[model samples]
Target: MPDQVTPPPSMHWIVPFAASLSEPCQHALPRLADAKALPNLRRLLGQLQEVARIEGDEYALSMPHERVLAASMGWPDVDGQLPWAAWWAAQDGVKLTADAHWGLLSPGHWLMGRDHLTLLDPATLALSETESRALFEAVRDLFESDGWALIWGASQRWYASHPSLQGLPTASLDRVIGRNPDVWLTDHPQARTLRRLQSEVQMLLYQHPINDTREQAGLATVNSFWLSGCGPVPACTATPAHIQLVNALRAPMLADDMPAWLDAWAQVDNTVLKQALQAVDAGKAIALTLCGERHAVTLATAPAPGLGGRMWQSVKRLTSSRSGPDPVALLNSL
Candidate 1:
């Protein structure tokens, strides 16, 4: 179990985009992040006791933050096949057994360009609950006919279960957003079927009235879906209810909207980072994981930093609370 988590035994806040910005985005944010504007971020860094730095390639099926979640829940890292739909469906009150294969299906638009196809973030679709369900229902028969049982999870997340989804390696939605998805596709026989299904879905919804109305209103129309989180219900410790995955920076960072990203960071600095410092000052152990594009650095106020105390003894580098990477540099490396 490499890169295992050594979480401080209290509130754990997993803040993505603390360093996950794209190369261009990374430069802009770090340049603007002076010590004065980010008081809590700087102050919180001063208390970091131990760090479990996790690394994976940017092209890996799973993102660094997803790896952190798998480690936190004590699940084996299988790249992209972590059965996310099963867990999410269970959270949404769907019953499950150990044998069924589950996949999370998110419906969104794929921006067709001359050279590459880009999958937009699901949130960018702006589909209402009613619209999402309608879109799901419209395509329900297509998937059900192929033996997948489908359920509507939320506007941005849909769930499906079928035996064939087992062991099918798919890209994490985070990995492919804002980039061409073809380059990230793993070679799996089942993936070809999925791609055919993607085409069928595009044709099915291309002339549908929802897309027509959406085009009229200037919103991105539903074109295709990105599927990931494929596998059986893994046998492991339950996904922690305590970890707060602060996602304020995800959308804007993916969209390359720097203003929104900075605004989101400002909000996070005020709310999440400020509260984290308060917890530390109160003598409570807290864990903060800063996730970036290819690496994730998890810091805990664990008092002791050692091989036994750190995660993935093979992968970590210890830093004193006083001497860690420069805040800006840390963000850039991630």
Candidate 2:
């Protein structure tokens, strides 16, 4: 079975795509919007301590959540170059050979814009299990001939283990959504080999029957594969299973559908945030980590214990003469 990331109810809700780089989403979001609109979310934000902030450029090679995952897993290079395949393969009980490194190779479409090529969302590929297996068989020999061990994890997830993966930095699939790969592509010399491999896959796929069928059906054809989550498997602490990850806005945000995003956010605000506030009332230590293209901010339960503690906090706030960060401003910028 595919590993679904569900952390425990000590519940650190990692909300991905909480903000967007698209103008439509940027303009139509919690930004400029009143706090009263999302009461539960607003209350939760006010209640939690703004503990950690991981900031980056929106154009960074990895999404902010990737950095969060790496940190939570206690790995080095927490800046987003996560050894995703190695870690995922480990979860799937795939053996790691001596001195091996691993990476995820996702087969998908690359649409040529007027000037640069943009990678489409992999979900749009709609590859079925049988079709994915067939495509894998066709492409496996190429990777094997290049001295790599490629294994199938799922229709969308293919794993490749090789020593060459060490120190090769590629963008997270989340980071590359609807964007050109060129900007985030690493300057590492080893990247040339992956580029060559990608070109080979494109050429092979161009004449494949799957593309012909997809084209006839008015669907995007699978043209190439993306290499990401590159690194050698490292000794790392386990991610606490109690931390929950809420991905309600991921799909809508990635598709650039602001309306759908608003709807989903409403649902999340009603369901997830409502339950989160309830959890707080029950005195469970929970948190909300809202992740955007460039940053992840973790809002944890403040350590105030009683009325006296609360009064002290208020006094400090007054002495500092600084209000807490405006939730509106933070979400808007994110």
Candidate 3:
């Protein structure tokens, strides 16, 4: 007869994008500032502090979302040059050309603020597949005319290929949304040419039929495109099989919509975190990594200790003058 014993629970990894749970500006929003708003999140943090162990050295400050994804795929330290466009294109079944650089071309609105221009969140564009393809067709010649190849992938995400863009470092879209674009533009030697291309594309799309239709509908016009993740395919090591990511909060966080951010957090807490807790209770190994704008905190299920080990830990705790770092404090620090 086969063995009747069940295997121990496998380790699971959870990554929540843009929790930025304790924003300084949130103090102004009463609903957001209330500790009662995200009960499950707070509960999860408390449980981790009491039962799980924290790995403080894993924190990454001011880290880009793409860098996290890259690291999860075993490609850490690629930072600003992760070649996300190539990865996305491959995921969409698009073949790449030899020695060509690929970039994500997202249609977005650039709002003219009192002092500077802000790139509004791309999600607000509400661009449909047909509309995206039409816009891509309208501007395809502009890129081809400039010796660059343009391919329409998914809605609001087109891929462009250019030889000059190879090895060019571009900021991730997450880093620039709802902020000034000038700061994130590449300072590489070939940036001038890329800037000129951007200008020409903007000019061409200024009065296109699509923009006219959008304007007639009182929607934000798709006046410009953001080119990022520009580079050749990056070499990566082994990719993890089970790294779960929750990013519903990204759009709201970038748009500075506090209520939406809180709602998204609630959903994650109720669904993802709740499930993780149950798994942990069932003797399953699990890990949670909370990421904010500046840092990330990871907590994993603590290993079981024997009676002797427990006694030793208790004695050590009684003799120690200092306490371990507070998980809540660490989260707020992020």
Candidate 4:
């Protein structure tokens, strides 16, 4: 007799920005407010909120991006101790020990307004790979001279490593994007050293040819670098075994582009959500987890019960006057 083959584990669909649908998209997406407009999403979320076991709390909703990262990487929390640098390094095929702390060095423009300093979106810098490398080279010696090791990961993400960064808590990029970096700056012992490096890097790039070229081309100057993701690789722990993340809505959502966000949502609803519903209908055991800045809600198909059990549930519902969560209300809250 042939040996029996085991089936693969069920897939878990993780959707970010599920709750915080952009306000601009609201008028353009009035149907989204009507749960019937997005039946797949509404049905899946309603089922999950009604039946599936939930993890994390309302606070987890506040940083949906970091929450997704922590859950995917099996980190404990989004607190400053999240090992974002190590996680990012791993993505670049570089391995760091649990004790090797790291920070992301991203070029950004600092806008000076009345009584405040705003850090523009790093993406708005529109830095090409050639220019990013040039700026990195000019300041590479500054970090190296201070006994730190710099590694270029991508056009926008450079890394700096130092032993002193261990146990230092740093804010995630999501928290500082389009906000005052000074307020979100790390409040650790090593913060002063990191700030000094930022100052020197700014001065070095202030007069570089790259900035001159960018300014002449009407591009935001890559004047300063943001230091974040400061922590060593954390030990991996148990997490969802078969999970896929869908975050196509993030970019437009962050930029507050309602039309583009709506288009992206249409794609997600037609593609990812449609496939998920089909899988569930085919008797596959699957779960859909929708996350906002504050909460994460998981949904799965409920188990069938005996006839007597069904009757009991019906009676109890009529007697208790309790109903499951409202999907639209939940999303609006996020």
> Which candidate ranks first by TM-score, i.e. highest?
2
Q: lDDT score of model 4?
A: 0.69
How do the residues 166-204 of candidate 4 rate in per-residue lDDT, one tens digit apiece? 777776676566668788776677789978877887788
Off by over 4 Å in 4: 1-9, 21-31, 50-62, 97-99, 236-241, 304-326
Candidate 1 residue lDDT tens string, 195-311: 888899999999889889999999999989989888887765366877988999898889888888888888898999899989977868888888888889888875644656545
Best candidate per lDDT, number?
A: 1
How far out, in Å, is residue 115 in model 3? 2.4
The TM-score measured for candidate 2 stands at 0.88
lDDT by residue (169-208, candidate 2, tens digit) is 7788888878787776777888888888988998998989
**Clash list (residue pairs), candidate 3:** none
Off-target runs (Cα >4 Å) in candidate 2 are 1-9, 30-32, 78-80, 90-98, 236-238, 310-326
Per-model clash counts, in order, read 1, 6, 0, 6
lDDT of candidate 3?
A: 0.67
Arranged by lDDT, best first: 1, 2, 4, 3
* Candidate with the larger lDDT of 2 and 4: 2
